[model samples]
Target: MSTSAPASLTGRTVLVANPSADLYGSDRMMLEAVRGLLKQNSRVIATCSRTGPLVDRLQELGVTVHITEVPVIRKSMLSPRGMLNLARIVMSTFPRMRRLIGAARADIVIANTLTLPFWTLAARSCRRPIIVYVHEAESSLSRAARTLLTAPLGLADGVVFNSETSRIACKAQALERRGKVRVVLNGVQGPATSRPPRDHIEGPARLLFVGRLSPRKGPDLIIDAAALLRSMGIAVTVDLVGDVFPGYEWYEDQLRARVRELHLEGVVRFRGFQSPVWEAIDGADMMIVPSRGDESFGNVVIESLLSARPVIVADHTGLREAASGFESAVRVAPDDPKAVADAVRRVLEDWGHFRAVAMVEAVVAQARLGTDRFHEGFGRAVEELDR
Candidate 1:
């Protein structure tokens, strides 16, 4: 049976969060949720870091977006560097949040992350119910990160996880008192109609790897796999699609260094972060998800599938579940370049079979698991918090 809220929240007000707002997938999901909430007649006042790809998208959609800065302190905000960041979060965040919530008299607070101490603190003072949306896997995190993050878990009246893996991880990380955790998978919607075709894939077989340049994403392994493909005389081209996150230069350097060492420079290209990743994928023969740690749920994975792009993914937590139809996505060993190389060849060669199964999965996504379904489920989750 589906869960619905016992109480109504049609006239209630909510303070939705976008903690980092780094023009990434996280902010995009938050914006989509907020728009749905607005459609249901709930007043949503956004409190975020004040910049992202979603900002313009939201404005273009004609939503009322009020930005109250919620600084995202990646390192411990209580450390000397963290304390300075904490001070900034407090100084800029607290006052604006206090004024906004004070003026709006919000009934609910939907926090996008555990990082924003000021927003939830103000929500607590106002006696408003706070629903925490945990997009990350706290259990997969280093010990130090969990220590800094537990505060938000304790503060939340309820919790929403981005995927089932994230929900289990959240439960293991901390206890929820007022409400239980719910798994709300990220929504994947293709363009209203297809865009004009491009000829980028006319040469070699194009492959795409979307996300940051780091160990967790396992990009070096991907480069190694491409080099292996070159050795095997496969006409393949790999495009990596993200920049290094704050202070992760050493990890980025490692990937660049590997590309040089392996001589996969021409075969594998770092495309930086593309705004609409579909453009990159459309021109691709395949996609690779080389995650070292388990992904909570890769939006890119679903997005790739929706684009009818077959994938070769590491055997990680979320990918295992998402790659249900082995036809569309095949499993590879995490951090094993040779294994990845072997799997990619299989997926591309058996393209006709995988493409058929992948399209069926895409039908499920575009039909059953559309944004409206996300709205009905997540809006009900928020309404439950109101009760």
Candidate 2:
């Protein structure tokens, strides 16, 4: 990796490819990166497989978004039918991608996630420098699946990792060891300094969980912990403030059923998909990130801290890195409702102390995770490719 400062991106035309059209953590970060690139006076053309809210959002940000036939390579792609589907999509989409790149005359191509290897193929044909921003930790992937995901990384001119945990995971795969790998931590626009503190301490301790209500995000575990807290005679209310993915509506249905089965209908409220998530975070006494699966990075964890609310996260993957250096934030074993319940109880028991610590820590964390710094680091990493 080069130690030189980032070269300017002025007048550069860059093409960005993202796997999903949803506004999840990775998608949101990609948008942020594009915004940063635009600020540098670079023209950006973004491509994705599907069309949804993210496409509209990008257009609003002055980005030209193209809905391409690029197949999203996932674990399913390992299956026989999936492999055939992938082959068909790649064969069909390759010519179109080549035309798009030629028309745009892109100076650099950025593939937002590891799942989108098609970008590498397209960029290579155009002879453009490529950057792969890896936001996933393959700890949960099967050996064959992980190989499929990491193999194409070697073809890139540069790779950007959202967290050190993700960087380490990629290194362990032994893929593209020679490429310039840089850890560019995800950034969030933190709340203002004069924001009001959470005041609901005397009555029910309002706990909040914000993320996609999926199995990996552990919305069910949050509900389970809420039940455990109630059974322990703790007065607590959990606000689950995010919706499930399109095909994963069944998981949301299961969560609602679990709330009823545990008789926690009153305690766990499903507040679907709150924008400016700080609004939800601000109303909580403390935040809980009970992720059952390995998280490459925990954006919500940082958001909670920036909101001056202490967070209790699962002690696994990049979440551990997110919660590091903050005494107010607590980490418990992943998938353990008992551990989550205990951590919640501990926060509530010393609510004032934890709240004070959070308020102080928020200032520090906000300075460290600002958008300017993130963009500067990201631009520098990309600029290194030009160097």
Candidate 3:
């Protein structure tokens, strides 16, 4: 992506408030947003709750970093105990966030996700333009919950949703009424050199799943599908390529237990979170993203397409948006092991045709979902908000 400074961002200080310092999907997108601002010659200041891989990456990019604790709301926080913890975080961090925004003298404040309403509240108090990049679509939540989660958008000067699915689910009608919403598709980095799908298959068709091993992400479904595929006499090896969040270890244990229960322990391999996942993508014959829960957008789906690898993704929400109009990406019913297995079987049966289509679709994905487009969209949003 070109770094030439957009007129609005030139020499302007942009404060970025991200909840986590991990290099996951939303975290990585936040990194891309920072990259775009830096390329445009804008001064960037980034604040995260703690230091992790993302902080290191931001430091490498020369962004001024502050380890500032901030309140990050989650679904679990709907309960009494969770509410108390959230209250404690807000009480402890809101003043710091307000002070940081003032000290930075940021022309505009960018909050990476809606989870951090405290940042928006702080930016509002500082009289800085605020942009909250919405990477979530919590339609599954109760109406009251959705209202509570999105109430912070009322304070934002601009609200950028990663997908239309997210935009609609967020119910940002107030923002919409004010013409403050933009749906910027998530930008993904693909392999540097796109290769055709392997021509000769000498062994079991290698299948890969690349996301958190959480029940929501449905890593266990891959195991179930593998067992189903085996029963159908289709040879395959399943690789689950990401780890769970801190509290989701139980889900991982359940996945392993299921593998043992099915007696396919040897057929499934647990590959912990691998960065620059192009290697795993290259090694696998095909990919499956069977998310059973809400996904704002499926970056992995786009990555698979860009690498010329066929993918099977859930047909709902942003996953559908990401893989739409691409025949190379097979959309299966969410949380269905049989559907996943059938999709895998279809690809293997017509491997040659799907492989060729994958190459063609890769070019289209590059044109439509490339990093440049991602950068351009955010740059435009900033310019509009500044005006």
TM-score of each: 0.87, 0.94, 0.97
The regions of model 1 sitting more than 4 angstroms off are 1-7, 75-92, 142-144, 172-179, 194-203, 249-253
TM value for model 1: 0.87
lDDT of 3 by residue, 130-177 (tens): 999999988999887777788878888989899999998998898799
Best by TM-score: 3
Put the candidates in lDDT order, highest first: 3, 2, 1
lDDT of 1 by residue, 1-387 (tens): 343432466767877877765656677678778866776678677765766667677667665567766666564453556656577647765777777777877788888855665666778877888778777665766665665665556766777777887776655344444346677777765755443222233467777898888888888887888888888888788899999987898888888888889877788888897877788887777788888975767677777777777788888777766665546777888889999899877866666677677766666666644677777677877776556
Task: Give the top-scoring candidate (lDDT).
Answer: 3
Against the hidden true structure, what lDDT does model 2 obtain?
0.84
lDDT of 3 at 28: 94
Which residue pairs show backbone clashes in model 1? 77-82
Better candidate number, 2 or 3, judged by TM-score? 3
Model 2, C-alpha of 47: deviation from truth (Å): 1.8
Clashes of each: 1, 0, 1
Note the Cα lDDT for every prediction shown. Answer: 0.72, 0.84, 0.89
What residue runs in model 2 are displaced by over 4 Å at the alpha carbon? 1-8, 79-81, 172-179, 192-194
